[model samples]
Target chain A: MKTVSPFLELESGPRVKVILDDVALSLPQGANLAAALLAAGVPVFRDTPISGAPRGPFCMMGACFDCLIEIEGTTRQACMIEVTDGLEITRIHHDEALA
Target chain B: MTRSDLAIIGAGPAGMAAAAQAAELGLCVTVLDEQPRAGGQIYRDVDRVAPLRGDILGAEYTYGATLTASLKHSAITHLAGAIVWAIEDQFRISYTRDGRGAQLDADHVLLATGALERPMPLPGWTLPGVMTAGAGQILLKQSGVLARDAVLVGSGPLLYLIAAQMVRAGTPPKAMIETQTRSDFISAAQHMGGALRGWRYLAKGLKMLASITRAGVPRYTSATDIAVQGTDKAEAVSFISNGHTQRITCDTVFLHHGVVPNVQAARSLGIAHTWDAAQQCFVPKRDEWGQSDKEGVFIAGDSAGIGGAKAAEYAGTLAALQIAFAAERLTREDRDRCAAKLRAKLAHEQAARPFLDAAYPPYAQALLPDDSTVICRCEEITAGDIRGYAKLGCIGPNQTKAFGRAGMGPCQGRYCGLSVTALLADARGQTPDETGYYRIRPPLKPVTLSELAGMEVTTPDAVH
Candidate 1:
């Protein structure tokens, strides 16, 4: 569902690498979530419903319970979640059975 | 910056009475109120449309003018429509008026911001056709507009008073639903003995009941489960009474479950408060003089607690006397005598409170409506979202933040705090209050970034 909410827009930044829930990801400069995860330098995807499973961004504007991950020891709504360089995101609940 | 010996923050009965008494004792007083008109909500002028000729507008005309004129005669100043947004220990106040922010200083301050009707979320409560009984009165009294037909729901002295006002104004309501059961009336009666000190008050309450009876407004006592039904507006309401579902089709529903203190100022000041289960709202703790634990800060009237106009008047006098006595303006004996009179008034008000509470307990069932019910009207968050968070091991508001964005809305949990507590209790098989709602932290209202830009930031040297 396309939804409208408030967000601080940014422009013109260098690509930074950050990890969300230990997920290694490369993001554009000024891309908040991408920058934070690459800075954390972990390659984890998402979080779990129960055992802190791996989850990634779903509804970013604070709607839809999808893109929730622990960043800097605080669980934040991913869409509304801002990103910075060298940030660490942790996974809680719904652990992935690594293949 | 303007300064005064005492700054009163409302022009209601308590504020007016306090200012008058303090001024009479040779204290310089200034009354700052947010209304263009002197009288606050309770004694709002009804003279906008009709002439001040009848007994109906008698209280407003008498008290309002007398208070305004008294302040004029004595060493008291009146600043109307001044919204005092912040207060500190040194008696500095920040207020906004005419789109400008200003600060005033005082030696002593009395806060009498008064009360607001408890917001109950029935279906379509946010619709245009629904309003608080108090709001309805304001529209009729201030704006001279009346709903073609209104259904007054909830019970208490105010309920009957408003109903009588509506009926007398030729805008008779279709029904008056009393949520208090007859059985509960017994408890309410126990407090009647205290109120029996005044024959006139008893007579007035009886007269109101008589008026309501004469209006032939259907009284649905022992009513439960009130539901307002409408898509874009409140078209009607349904309630189950005596094991039967009855519906009242009306254009407007005026609801007044009870009153809650306007705690924005109190919370911002960090004054300690205790839950007043009787009124189902938090009341600031105060001494006999209405002085809070926060030094140099005093509370008065319903803001200290929910007392009627009469009780509030006495409380104002008591608070003023205490301040005066402390300043050595009055002997200890005079303060004690004043305190004795205040004690009597407080006792009478307390005695009547049980009857009022029993007559209208906070409609607990109203908090937990159907799952599809919208808990946060501003955010459109339904009861289902709350439940979904709980199912995902979300223990409380803090933990629930991870699972679902419940309470992460513009209101900052004011509208949903009580309901969220109730929902958490039901999920955990605990009491609602035990679940514990969110703490009210300051900057109560949301302020724009630009507004914050002009604010004075505190430095380490400014701490003292």
Candidate 2:
């Protein structure tokens, strides 16, 4: 585990390449997308629409919408999505200026 | 649309048990679940994660596999990864799966949608690194991930369980800030008789606490005025303990007080709900058999109320037995005989709740945080906003929609509904029942218009 990362992965697996905000990442394939992102040091899932405040998963059970992120083309809860090869993920925000 | 004699939404202990029991009684059952597998939040990803981390997660989690295994019957069809959005009339359930929408009709509908952690709203809860202990547990279960140097906050057995689980994972929490005070324990002592009858739950909690103690995680009880300290993301937690303010620096803050019944679908279906004073949330009204006031609808599991897993399983089977008898597949006597043990077991499982509820009431500050604390994350609405709306003559959560758009965000107030109700109730000098919750409607979860457009078009729903 890296000293810089706030989270530590308990298991090791073959990494699959994916891109977040145009940055290439070798995330563990089939792992929870939210956990993988947090472990990889991407804390901000999406900025709020009104205040542009940073947010991440809270409930992680699909109840809280704080973890919403754009996967492929649609905005979905990162906690509910699985990391896969070639998955293009980015911040999901209604505020265009923040984007 | 697929048709079945019974349709169960959620594949947790309740849904799976209900499906198995009803199917065994010659009823065709279909169980729809959001996860790719059966285990609900309590034992999420059981089959996949249990084999690897069963000891860390503890035995109670792995036990869910027994319920999951029962779904292998041919009479029971399990639809995994299905997000149920609408529960229409006549038991027509609409859901989205893999970006596609589908509908199913059933003779009876059992909603085991389950419970969600009652939001612990504080100054910096919306920050990136702040999450619920349940969320942390989910990462541990689903992906074997653990937060480094995290501080656990709030009250209840769940906090202790997660702390111990983290300890077992070889990364104990830096500290635990407890909200339950000495008076809370004194009040909880009144329920000792029931607590005694439910000794196993008490034993489990003690065992978890023992593990945390063994790991030397500093635990502070009676913490108050708790707040996360950070600007952009969570950096630490600040709280008052024993008349002194203390701050613990940590990247992650896991906050939890207790869980409340996930009542979105139940309320959307227009099931009658009463404000549960002890649990401090609105719960759907149901009979002993889990039959709701609505015809042909049954609410079970934590979705009905926060009864935990074992109670939910028993409740589910009881509901299924009642449904079987109503369907005329089983005689009334037969149904009663089958449900006799289940009802007893359900009551037994619920025996310790009174003590737990009194001991770990929702954090007072979190229930109504300071003026600047954000209560509604979706809208960035603060507690002061709701209190302001009340001053402007807003008496209910529904009025907040027009007064300030407090709960009109994407989540439709799931996280902030209870807090809004409490704020309004406190402002208006009324009880929570008088200050009713938001009137929920269908398309419960956020669903894209395209998903609805592509849904099965036959037999259009009459616009309400």
Candidate 3:
């Protein structure tokens, strides 16, 4: 698959395939999850539970919760998480579902 | 429970310096951080990234490798990838690591959590294509990613540094939309004497500007009324510069003004804070030793205030010296002697701050955005909502939680606390100090219930 990322990588290494929101993306291992997704061209991380507005990585650091995603039934900051192979990631939706 | 002489939270410049210093002073120190590696945002992934992109990031960033190297000591334990959630009573630190919760009991606690980019809450700022320049830098550092045709927005020394870095990376931004004007320079001119004393910083800024100029990127200075123009994502940046309205087409918009201390963890401990008028943010109150108003708790580095990375290391060492004296590892004379030169160096590093703060003051409108702009990204609370809350007798940020869940979202007001205070203060005719910040609630950074419940409560003290 061709990379649709608007982001360019200075270096690329081993590829690891992960499923994000039911779509498979071959991302670079050892990359921060948020950056890896952007490098893979995965659109928005999750829609705002309040207004259903699209939000992605804003602060990249842990301070902002803009890039919230779910992996293995646990919701976490995509910026904080690492890129690992065979991971199943889902977009977090609904205020009550935030974990 | 893990017991240590001092539990330092964060592995950034301050935390690394403190841990190394305290360890050399014979204190058992354990440092924790959310990242899997040492070096906070300023130097994230220095061990890996520096070896590759050191020239692009510049020596200032790769210098973090020295701090990381100093942490190699037997007396210091680094708990990497630990997301600290709370600082409980009696210096008990609660955190999660690898899907499990844990606690650390320490004789003293040092917070060096560092700063967050002040949110520029304009319309369409929350769009996917809009991110802080800090975040963009993080992508470059951690993943070697660069955005295509990004427009750099706002003012600060950091904007120049990143623009230079991007130029070196072969992806110079479309244009620079800076807010600092002639009047800003005129206001900052009063501190020229002090700024001259901080010549190194000025020299570095000039070098970055030279690099950007060499790259031939268009610059729109004295820009005002800037907004991210897009229906769903940032397609362009529209602003007024030099008395003319203009728009620059771009795929990404990087926003920044300045950074304020990330004070949620420190504030949660009931640490007394004071408003810094020049910086326009509330910072934890601490003495020369970096000890907060609360007993046995110290806030070093940007967590205390926005001292640069070098100053942060000195501040951390000073805090460690104080802790060593308190721990009976160092005599009063020894502590003072060790900290004397450090305090002077820290002051020298910080001498540029007054001029920089005056030169790039936070945008007035963004602080208390006009009615329609969203102030709290977590709750989608508009600026008008906060104004309405003040009219309805909402005196402080805490009231917003009840009025509209402004600070009750998952982020716990890390991004919106200052804006809420500013808006309420504007509407009620009160100072930011009088308006007051939110009462921070813990689990500071979202801990899973299972992790908390599954945490092992070992014997009170398990000294390794």
Off by more than 4 A, model 3: A1-3, A93-99, B459-464
Q: How accurate locally is residue B398 in candidate 1, as Cα lDDT from 0 to 100?
A: 51
Where is model 1 more than 4 Å wrong at Cα? A1-99, B46-54, B57-64, B198-200, B387-417, B421-437, B446-464
Following a full C-alpha superposition, what root-mean-square deviation does model 3 have from the true structure?
2.1
- Write model 2 residue lDDT over B1-464, tens digit each, in one string: 67899999999989999999999999999999999889888879898888898989888899999999999998999999999989887878889988888888998999999998898898788988999999999989998989988999999999999999999999999999999999999999999999999999999889899989999999999999888988878998998999999999999999999999988888898888999999999989999888999989999999998989999999999999999988999998888888887778888899999999998899999887899988888888899999999898887899998987888887888899999999999998999999899999878877888787887757745675
Candidate 3 global CA lDDT score: 0.89
lDDT of 1 by residue, B194-236 (tens): 5565555567778888988897878888888888887544668
Error of 1 at B375 (Å): 3.2
Q: TM-score per model for chain B alone? A: 0.87, 0.98, 0.98
Candidate 3 C-alpha lDDT tens digits along A14-85: 989899767888888878999988877765788787887888899999888899998888888999988899
Error at B90, model 1, angstroms: 2.8
TM-score of each: 0.73, 0.97, 0.97
Best by the DockQ measure: 2
Clashing pairs in 2: none
Docking class of 1: incorrect
Model 3 CA lDDT for position B174: 89
